[model samples]
Target: MKALSTALTLAMLAGLAGCVGQSGSAASAWYDGRDAIPPRGDRIYICHAFGCALKTPVDFAGRDIAALRRILAEGRGSPAAERRAIAKAVQWQERRVGKIVGSDKDVGGLDMQNAGVPGQMDCIDEASNTTSLLLVAEARGLLRHHRVESPVARGFFLDGRYPHATAVVRETASGTAFAVDSWPEANGVEPHIKPLAAWFNDYPS
Candidate 1:
């Protein structure tokens, strides 16, 4: 039933404004019509309650930037090392933003039980938020080996898979995109970062 709910939630959301999931330009159209990404290290919008039904503004102050810089510096040597550091950076971001929005208590994945509630994040929410955080790191010049790309989605309900989305990063050297997915885990835990190709066909099994 939970799986059904997840598919329903995603399908229902995609129907709104005829917006598809967060992939390419579609992500902007879905979230508050935010067609343009804000300046780096600026105030960010947190998407929760599924389909970005709730958007809360959160600022990344100097302290947060400092922490991000320090964390990302650890991965400057190699793309592999940077990805590990990216996970740490994302974990920190989840904790930081969660405290302000009370999303620290949010359950992971598609949670109809917390629908319209204060702190539930489906894959869409997770994808958007993680993308925003990654942009901040990129803007602050904290990212060295990988360039943050637009968020992407996979699956279609008719294909026997639930629609899902995730943030992405591209390795500058190899041009390989990796999925940064947070919806499968609890808040503050690092998302599963995997090759985007693998993520698209076989995830959330």
Candidate 2:
């Protein structure tokens, strides 16, 4: 719910930017009649790390949950299978938001490359509601498919602080750990494990 709230706030701000809106729906507003969301199986949710003043990832035009979940379920037993699942999840999320371009080999599109722009113009709205739900669903689905026994926390990086809902995965086995954020440097890219005090000393409770 905290993540959704953060996402909704971002979406409302983007809507105020005067570039996104449609039928009073944030999704319709951002797409502007373009039918370009990628396959559902590949979409991965991203959030803003610095603040909520970034563009949101457009939801690809025709993604269904079942399809998205199925695609995210790929990569059962390969080296970096978790990585593959992460990549595919991001692609699915990016495409759904209509941010991806052809042959990019990455999700979150130009935003992925820049790492600053949010996933969509209406990301906040979508995230708090549809997008966030989809992302969380995918994340859970991944755990189920991989038989991963660790808990994954989901939350938002707001104003350089991680707030709202978050999952902390504490398992001895090596599992994937990364932040899905608007900062170009962190777009589906995992960073070295540093002490929480190092990056978020002023983190909110």
Best by TM-score: 1
The parts of candidate 1 lying over 4 Å away from their true place are 1-41, 203-205
Ten-residue stretch with the least lDDT total in model 2? 163-172
Off by over 4 Å in 2: 1-50, 53-63, 99-135, 138-140, 145-172, 179-182, 185-205
**TM-score versus the correct structure, for each prediction:** 0.84, 0.34
**How well does model 2 score by local distance difference test?**
0.34
Q: How many clashes does the backbone of model 1 have?
A: 0
Quote the positional error of residue 75 for candidate 1 in Å.
0.6
- In angstroms, give how far residue 26 of model 1 lies from its true place: 12
In lDDT terms, which candidate is top? 1
TM-score of 1: 0.84
* Candidate 2, residue 32: how far the Cα is off, in Å: 29
lDDT tens digits, residues 54-117, model 1? Answer: 7888888888788989999999999999999999998998999888888999887656788777
Candidate 1 achieves a global lDDT of 0.77
Tens digits of per-residue lDDT for model 2 on 57-134? Answer: 434334456655676567555424543554455445444444342212233212324333333322232222223433
